[model samples]
Target: MHKKKDNVFITGHRHPDTDSIASAIAYAHLKQELGVPAVACRLGGLNDETAYLLERFNLDKPVFLKDARASLDEIEMDQPITISLNASIKDAMDLIARNNRSLAVVDDRQRLIGMVTISNLAHIAMGDTAHTIDLLKRTPVSNIVRAIDGELVYESKTFDFNGKTSIATIAESKLKYYELKNRLVIIGDDIESQCEAIRKGAAALVTVWTEKISEEVIQLAKEFDCTIIKSTHGSMNTSRYLLFAPNVREVMTTELVYFNRNEFVDEVGRKMLETRFRAYPVVDDHDRLFGFVSRYHILNSHSKKLILVDHNEASQSVEGIETAEVLEIIDHHRIGDLSTNKPIYFRNEIIGSTASIITKMYQEHEIEIPKNIAAILLSALVSDTLNLKSPTTTPQDHIIAKKLEDISGLDRFEFAQEMYEATSNFKNKSYQEIINQDIKKFYLSNQEVMVSQVVIYHFEELDTIIDAFENEMDLFVERYNLDLLVVVFTSVVDNGSIVLASGKLENAVREAFPGEDRSFLENVVSRKNQIIPRLSTAISKYVG
Candidate 1:
């Protein structure tokens, strides 16, 4: 049976900051309180600022999601039908006919060794020749008896046989003309023919339609070290069933085509189209068989379910967001280019932080916010709005921050000081880490651009790493195929930023603010409200 996927993932955008991570966690917690199955996830690693806040609040980080594609674990597959390698071909055929599916041939330890299908058994059963009797050399005596529905009356201690089969007539004299040397002789219940066949070096005797053998013939068979079986059917049926008495190891196909359980469904579908098999085996990491996957399973499977937070643009969301089912979006940024198949619960407000919106959601739903959750939500608000000092801070943001301060019982100014100190230590971090700590991507007209930001205590700190930062920015632009790459180092204490530019459109940074120096911008604390709009305007004018 198929396992239903019910988890609704709440994720923030790539290169998450404190506000993005905190909003997802709080929103998912609120959703769970309302009886929804929700889990908070992160599209990328935590920055220094987010890590400090989570550690201070003693909360675990959200789950790191690599992509939104559905894996084979989400699909319903048929239960595995397996058979032993030592079983008879008739046993395999019986299982195949009953289940109407191919079988995975496993060894003693239940590890997959081969595969068997109806066609594999049919080819061996219908294409038998006299030379096919050679297979009986490896066939067990027990299997032969089971295949023909016969009883083993005698089992020799020193069994010896050439893999051959023949029929003996009622004429005892004509039995000598038959090649009875180490051959299984099938005949009626004639004591004379049974004794004669045994004495003529026959390996075994199948007495058809008989329940008993004479004492003299039994003694003779013991003297010849020959096994004896009494078949319930006539000679014709016994001979036909004997051809399939060999073990399945000789007929099973060993070269297998299979899939791992963790393989993505889209890639598995593409691989299935290149092959002609009806079904393929699914195995775990240990090579043990789990089940079987067919084309029907792929056709009916659904993608993962998600609820986006913090940002709404497709480029800023998780990888493979186009394939996931987006249920809702709760953000405080300008909506960009995310399109969904159906109407979603989209809540976008021009506020300071998404965490403020989430804090208000908890109050609207009448769920009491836990102390630790309240503290982290307050921290995210203070970090995003610069403790109510940024231009983007609204009256609603101040009202929500005051409400959260009462619930969390933390001084916002002291907590913000601690958060800034924790993130401002860039002396040990590499240029790549500094740039990627809080980065975003955008599509302006037809050009792809990347903007990275770092919040520091002082503007002079950039003098130490400015050369390395610019060198890495060049490589970053080439790696991501960007038309422009900009890095903004903002000092909230100074209320200004030092911006650097790289890539094909580096000159546009100078044109954005023509009166000021290219490196410095006063009273620019919010990238959402100040930096992106100026850059977008400049790039649009340059392209025109």
Candidate 2:
């Protein structure tokens, strides 16, 4: 599986239409053929017409991303270097030295428990008094032998050191005065002191620099139930090194600050500023360790790269478009409010659909267009031009549609009629679904307005669902905080539309059309040319 953050996404605007989706899919396929790591994405849910076309083509729905802001997953992070909870303090120091890191930690069941730093290790080593080694009694006897490189002379049974420890360098007679019962005694090659310690109930006996153990001393230690360890080093070094033999869990820091991979960059940065830690661990949703993230990684993060296909306005685009880098834009709509910091490849035209421009690009690159691509492209052209009936349909659109028809082996008129019939069947749909199937939001005269359009073969289909439409329109207006909500029911055969207007702007809609209840427009079909501009003008005049 590829990392999603590394892949470039080609997508369309919010509430995408057939042309918006088709052009994005076709362009993404073309780029992938030319060896670019690109995938098709959508910012919003699919409309009825777009969903129908995708189902006919056997294409998976594009990846949906609600926001485009940079996340922690996009930045490079440090690898996790962890040690077990039973590891020695010296082992933690060695690992940190080999990896060139400031700290090493301990874990249990894949969850971090503590951290072992240089300062903590030193405090444990030098901070010990005569009683500090008493804590080592809780540690395993095998760990002490390994830490000091010692061998058991008489007893090799597994056990823990749970007694006081002392250096028996005093007079052999004075050793009796000091309590040695259940205590660990460290002495140098002094056979008298070794025998004295084992006879007084010492838990373990460390004989420094001794290669051979006397048979009497071994027998005495066995009788006292004491473990006898023979060290290769002298007394001072053995005692000092024994402190490091305990587990690192005894010294690690349990309190820590960390982050997750899905957190936003800005929020994490704000949290990082509250502490002085050089780096922090990153975890997944299940609290499993992922890696480490540092301040440098956050400052040098990369932005998501994108190629817009149909629209460019911020209000019509994705939620976080301002944070992404727009490498190119291929649109056929009016240039709305969009700008960039540097020069980019921008192609905007007055053509009917974006599919026409993409088809021309395929010809210019001399790449063979696939049959599925041609079929979807032609469907988009027919839908946007309304079967060559809308005023926006140009000669170029006609020629390209005919060429695509030959490649797809499908008749244009039959396919268009079938697609419109399949998408316009509202028998099982709710009134809200019908109105929001292909809705667009716009701003006119500082007021938010919504325009929804649905095409049908005839007006008779509306007689069954007209009351439901008006009822849902009232709720839609209140829910969306819209000043006006207009649903344009256009007839494919008559080439005219009946406008249903509601909300606070009812007077503005009446001003736009003042005539009989069923007065039909002569040649008004395209919403871009005949509907939106006229409605904007009437609303402006009414508001003024």
Candidate 3:
């Protein structure tokens, strides 16, 4: 699934939380399990709790959660799964279900306004059913979808959805009935239907066999507000499927929440915790769905497009969960956001733990589980299911955890306890470092404000983080030379974020967010879509 290995692997959501960090670690383990040199990365810094957990577990920290600029230079958006910001619920659902990886919400110039994902669409489709949704993205609907096809599910006057096929009607003996409402029209040299269609309501009048549209008919259609799709289908077949006249753009998401090509996976995970969207869109600075994010996408996500291996789910997944194509899922959890086109040998089962499943599979199939791999998997199972405390856990998980523990020469209880300590040890680190280390960057462009934010879970560390923010601010202003800055500290456990710090570009932030502390992270700290755009406007104004 990961044809692009050069693309780095990232985890973390808009404001990556505990599970998000652990999940990325688990995913990186799976990648190494498959003999790939995958990097467990973050966009923001780790909070005190997560940092303590990692340190206690003696696990290595991520490679880095660099800026979006660093990320864009890393991944490629070739086979895209585009989304429109203003896409219909039906269209968004289909595109996400189809597993499109690179998607774009573009204007006429193919310029991206923003991107979306299956999860983002799912949130939109779910509508009010879930208040903790990532809707009301700041990006515009002008981020239109390129030409796409859709069934004319419903039409105002002239179009119909007919399952990707259409036909043009040859008006041979047309009379007063020539007033076409939901059909494509093809006129003959006789031109009676053309005149009647003009007077009636022919949306499109075409000279099928010929390359031309009769001037009078064309003029008539213009008066009736009809779009002409000229085809060599002899006006006969094209008219038949006129029901499918819907522009492919009709179904694309025109208004959506998307991240830059280099959005951080950790931040995305944090956002996911706050919402129920299983996927979302990943786009360029222009906001096109370069790829999609889903529960599966994030689970195996490595950077923007490539996928690693491991337990796949929105809760246990990486960032941009909506964008990447899931190559494979080697987990022991229930079938999660991961969906593959064809049957692939994914190792999911109703087992005690993913580690147990992996161990048994390795033994039965004669596959080797590296020492480090064994350690990582065992640690995840022990930490995730609370050493088999979770109802989702099984005996197999315990057995495998024990076996892996022996192989790694680690005590199960001690290892788990230590990992807990590492995550909880929250004091010395800066909020910026804590968030940044475990986060991913989306973008920093001239057109949009350069914004970087991280999600933290330790409320106990907030007061300290706030103090550290000023120093980081001084450093950030000099280091990155940014215009506006906004950092968010979100605790998924509490289900809210404390607006820890804000920068000098205050007016812009104020204007973009008409009020202070809008909704939760899902609505506010949704990184690329909800948060960055606010800063971008301010920066645009400030820079301008």
Candidate 4:
């Protein structure tokens, strides 16, 4: 009874900061309050600062999502109305008709066995006359009785008949003309003839039309060790019902083409073409039934609805953002090359943090900002704006931070310092781990460039790992075949960045800023406002 429900996933960019995470969580709350089902998601693992904030607030972390690709799990596939292996073919057919499905998944012990279709049942039903009797041989006497509305006059609890079937239509003189040895004989209400057939070594005797056999005939059948079943159905109806008495396992297609719930719809769509089956069962890794997917479901596939926060670049977004429909974008960074097929609600500003934009939206929508949520938003604002010290901090960011601070009852500068200190523990972390903590890629002027940023209160902690940073940059450039790899070390005290460059753009970096081993740019703390545009122009001029 648990049906798959589609919830819109709201997430932020890779290497998400406190602002990115808080914005996603807050916006998901807003949407749900507006009667829209939504889930907060995180594209990357939580940073130390954000993790500290979440623990302080006792909030459940967002579910980690690797990509936004529309998969079969997101689509409304047919319900898994599975049939048991012991169920009759007639029951399978009825289930299919009632559920408006082409086939029914056969399961045994809660695991997938096979599938049965209407065509499979039809092929067995309309086959040779003897095939029906052959199939019904393995059927239990109880099943045959239920199929044809019969009752067992005399038989053990585990009675079964797997012998030939013959109707006693001919005269008692012609009973020898047909083989009755070890065979089941369907006879009418001829008491003398029934006794004669039972005497001729019949394995079972089926009396149709509520026939009453005399006590002498019953005694003779017991002497011959024969089974007796009485039914109200006529001869033809009894035979047809006997055809459906066999278990569904005997007719289901065992060699199957199936899909998993996590498989992408586009990938499954291609696999569906290799076979002639119209529907394929969706199973788990342990081969348990999940649901059924059809070609028509793929044709009418629904793309995932997403709300992107913090960053907008496709490289920084989830893995399959192109496969999803972007409903809105709330960010404070310079927009990258993220384009949509349709127009969306895009709110981009030059504020210090994405949390500021989300905070303004809360007021616009008249939604109350909870105390814990306000603390997180204020923490993100202080972290991103660097306690109103960074060059990217606007007047609006300061105002929003003050307002959120009053609501959260926390001191802005002291909290900001603690937040920065919480994430600045780089002693044990490797150079690769430190630089990749907040990295974004860009495709500018036909060149693939990667820019990584790390924030700290002071620069003395990184003096030991400067060589390691350069080595990691070289390795990254070689591994990814990138045109250039840049690492910006932003310091809160200096209010500037120490830029490190490798690859083809090393000379471009020197030309942009003529300096010593590490190029120093004044008031260049923000990658969005200062570093990106400067590097974009330098790379474009150098490459062109």
User: Which candidate number would show the highest lDDT if scored against the true structure?
Assistant: 1
Local accuracy by lDDT, each model: 0.87, 0.80, 0.50, 0.81
Q: Name the weakest run of 10 consecutive residues (lDDT summed) in model 1.
A: 1-10
What local lDDT score does residue 179 receive in model 4, on the 0 to 100 scale?
Answer: 73
Q: What ranges in model 3 sit over 4 Å off?
A: 1-37, 42-44, 47-59, 64-304, 308-322, 331-346, 351-372, 418-544
For model 1, what is the error of residue 309's alpha carbon versus the real structure, in angstroms, after optimal superposition? 1.5
Question: Each candidate's TM vs. the true structure?
Answer: 0.84, 0.85, 0.33, 0.91
How many clashing residue pairs are found in candidate 4? Answer: 0
Best by TM-score: 4
Model 3 per-residue lDDT tens digits across residues 1-544? 5444454464544344344555566566655666776667664555665566566557787756434222432433335554444444445445655765434565655566655445444444344522311221221121111112211211224333112122324444445444355333455544555566545554334445554556675565566665454444544454432322233343344566555656555566566676665446566666444665555555454534434333455433554455554545555433545555456556667754444555675677566666665666676566445556544566677777778887777888777656554554455655455545433333333431234444333456555446666667557655765555555554423434444334456566666655454224433434433455555665577657
**What is the per-residue lDDT of model 1 for residues 1-544, given as tens digits with 9 covering 90 to 100?**
2234677889999999989899889998999889888889999999988998898889999999888988776678898999998998878878898999999999887788999988888888777565467688768888889889999989877657677888787763667688788888898888877887888898899989787887788788888899999998898999988888888888899999899988888999999998999999988888889889999999988888999999999999988999999999999888889999999899999899999889888989899999999999998898888788889999999998888888889888877777787788786788888989999998876789888888887777877777877889999889888899989888867877888889888878788866554457788878899889999999998888
Q: Which parts of model 2 have CA positions greater than 4 angstroms off?
A: 1-5, 102-137, 141-158, 163-238, 406-409, 456-460, 491-495, 513-523
The alpha-carbon deviation from the true structure for residue 460 of candidate 2, after best TM-score superposition, in angstroms, is 4.1
- Each model's number of backbone clashes? 0, 1, 106, 0
Worst 10 residues of 3 by lDDT: 139-148
* After superposition, candidate 1 runs with Cα above 4 Å error: 1-4, 33-35, 52-61, 108-111, 145-160, 166-178, 185-241, 368-372, 402-411, 458-460, 492-495, 514-522
